[model samples]
Target chain A: MIARLRDGLAVYFCLLRGALAARMTDRADLGISMIIMLLADLVVPLTTLLVYQHGAGFTGWQRDEALLLQATFLIAKGIAFPFCFGMIWTTTELVREGTFELLLLKPRSTLLLLLGHSFQPEDTGKLLGGIALFCLALPNVTIGADADSSAALLGFAALLLLAVLTLFGFALLMTCLSFVWIGNSRLQEIFDAVSAFALYPHGIFTRSALGWLTWVIPVSVLGYLPASVLLGRPDPALPLAVGGALCFVLVVIGLWRMMLARYASAGG
Target chain B: MNRLLAAWRSTCAIAYATYQEWAAYRSHMLISLFIGPTYFLVQVVIWQALLADGGTIGGYDRTALMSYYGAVLIVSTLVFDFADWNLQMLIRSGKFLTVLLRPMSHRGFALSQKLGHRCLGLWMEALPIWLILWLVFSIRLVPASTGWFVLSLALGFLIMFLVNYCVGTLAFWLTRTAGARRLIGFLRDVCAGVFLPLALFPHELQQLLFFLPFQFITYVPVQVLLGHYELAGIRLGIPEIVGCQALMALLMWGLSELLWRLGIRRFSAAGA
Candidate 1:
């Protein structure tokens, strides 16, 4: 098992089995950790739940609708975290300690190996919390029974995957930023500062601010757009949103490859 | 008395070193300086959306709401403590040995370092952020009394530092406390009203929060700044709030010191 962990190029199942075994060795400990994270995930929604109940909610969202949006954000974050978002810190540490070069030299795909190494299985608790909240709020929300409802649900699932990919691209950018700013990198914190806006409904923001989030940072891809599909809203920009997300994924992937190539030649 | 004086002098030297260390990284710290302003901007937009029809949120009008958000940024930055993360890094890197060999307690060293770091932050981040909020958003900070405002804020710094100090000492038992610290930090941010004003919470929840020292960190100081303390029935004025905060800080310090003492025993046994 240890050897499997040391060798990232080992079979995918072998890597996952080794990780599961190690994490399962202390099941109670793992459970406690997950519970702690789940509680943390609940805090923001709980606060917002109280705030809405107290009679102040966003422009287009009441208590239940706001909960749905918050749950959407959490679900996306939870899914993205274990696979991609958490790796931002891992890559930053690697670049800082000069071991990132060693990672590049590995036989397998570097990004895949990074993902395996940085997998945070405990973050599933976040996903579970989001699902629980979504379930509680779903019935309170009305969805059209027409053919568009099925299409919107499918779109919600597909767009959810793209949203996670969009976040991965941002993480890739932050990794490159870490390389440029060797000692201290608050680039990720800037991402976080911007991401706080994602917690609220998009209608709360000005048109220009929404435009910026949609195109520049694309944070709405993480929550608002996905929730729109779930709510069966006839989004005129559905095609635009999908095309923009795909283009962003391509651009960041290209940038990540370029950065990797530069690291190969520069050696520093 | 002589030994206490010596330890005090040594801590002062450590604080000076920490201040210089942070000063050298000022440019890197600029990102954090911008976080407050960015966060306040988001709050302004959100409240604007909520109050578009010109309604109050938990008794706060639009201008009052903006000022409260601005006040929160100032206080949260002022009282921010990273002892938990710092301790985790020190322990992970095996540099905690240097701390163990010192005559003074790690809490004292960490607290002194925090003090010097925040003293710089007061000028570098907090004040400038306040000025920007005022100039850009026209969010006026109308403190009922400067004496109480400063007093509450100073006490808040001590209380938050001690809470974080207790959390940091848990590193002795846990190998990696990044997640734990982050969770605690998140709770503190929420419970302390950094995310939203505590007034916006339900009355029952707000009453429950009064018992937790987290409220003293950002909410109390902000309340004093907004003159909401008088509205909350703080009839005794500046001295009473100052005294209450000092009492909370003392209690937290005692509890944290007890934990540290016990934790160090476990740590020494583990040769960590």
Candidate 2:
């Protein structure tokens, strides 16, 4: 499995490089896409900081801690970007245009093939922004600098990767809804709308009934729960992060397999 | 006067025809209805959370925030224009030539058609949600001052329409206005207090955003409806909100018309 995964990663990178090469011909679009992405990354955190400092401090987390949550969101978006962002919309077009059939004849799983084909080169900027924000925000966590706790930090990093995987799984689930709701672009718009809710600090929703939504939907887990755990906030429910990730993986794989059986390929 | 009346009547007829075309897609309309409500519900949930801690944000309490967001959902749906998207498509497909040969003014036809679509769309999707919120949430209204609210909303609509037209006109030169649209949308969402109350923005940013036109389209009308302005009962304060909205509306409308003329001239010269 590890070998296959490595091979898949190698193939994915090669395909991504090809896409980047193709995108380079359209340098103007690439430049605009980069600027938009940089602006998106900058605006969210800045808006949060402005809103919190002006209105009231965040309910559960301080400014630096909230920035960490924002960083987690950017990182999750970065991880999902290379794989999901381009494919979600393009998949609908493929299905509508009956071009998806060309994808199924490939040697690999169609999911992996689609994932490899749909890389957005501009998201590299987003990924770098996420890392920069994470690094900048990292120092604000008051955890003592002890060499022994490096293991816990490593564990946390692993959990963060799991969180990204879960987010991708969920995004895939939303995109796959297009297969079921064919010809209705409103589903895509609705997904965009719901995803907008994830842009803010999840601690804002602490006592509301929709707080369950943050956990069950794992929108907050993409940022809030992992950030909270890493910041060493006392929460007995920290283990749920691992559980959510596992469930997300299992459910997403299960759903994709089920849908794969029903996918009638659009002629390429 | 008769000519103007006839033009208005013909415009209304075209609008009705467009509405009928939209109505033909029942499944699409139903899906839109479902999506619209769900989107508003999510906004409500977010605002509820923001106000959950019983803390004041920008001097807005929980109920006030709910009323503001609920009003925004309704007002935005009502005033929203899709002419930008339409303009982009027209420019890309070179459909403006067809409009240029028509008897009526292109801008007039485009604006009226959008107005008709908005009216039809609101009746189909937004009105029910607005009524439900009003009844269920006891959303406060600026009663006996219906004129003030209506006039403010009109100004808001004009601002929204002009801004969309201006942004869409950029497509003539830029080839693709999606980037501009996205940036505009982001700015609008933040500054117009669509996601949260604009008051929550830092005083500096809020002041800066006041110079930008997005606030006129969404925030002001919502504020008017929620009776945020210092007006005593039974007194009309249309001038305050309406004045600002009218000024911005005129500025944006003038700028958009200028751009549209220049853009069309460029396209004509290029034979695009």
Candidate number with greatest TM-score:
1
Residues A20-49, model 1: lDDT tens digits: 687776575567667766787787688678
DockQ of all predictions against the true structure, Cα-based: 0.42, 0.34
**Candidate 2: where are CA atoms >4 Å away?**
A1-15, A41-44, A144-149, A192-211, A264-268, B24-55, B131-144, B202-208, B230-236, B268-271
Provide all candidates' interface root-mean-square deviations.
Answer: 3.0, 3.3
Which candidate leads in DockQ? 1
Model 1 C-alpha RMSD vs. true structure (Å) is 3.8
In order, candidate lDDTs are 0.77, 0.71
- Runs off by more than 4 Å, candidate 1: A1-13, A16-32, A145-147, A264-268, B1-8, B88-97, B172-179, B230-236, B269-272
lDDT of 2 at B93: 80
- Model 2 Cα lDDT, one tens digit per residue, B215-270: 88888888787765521122335567668778899899889879987988778622
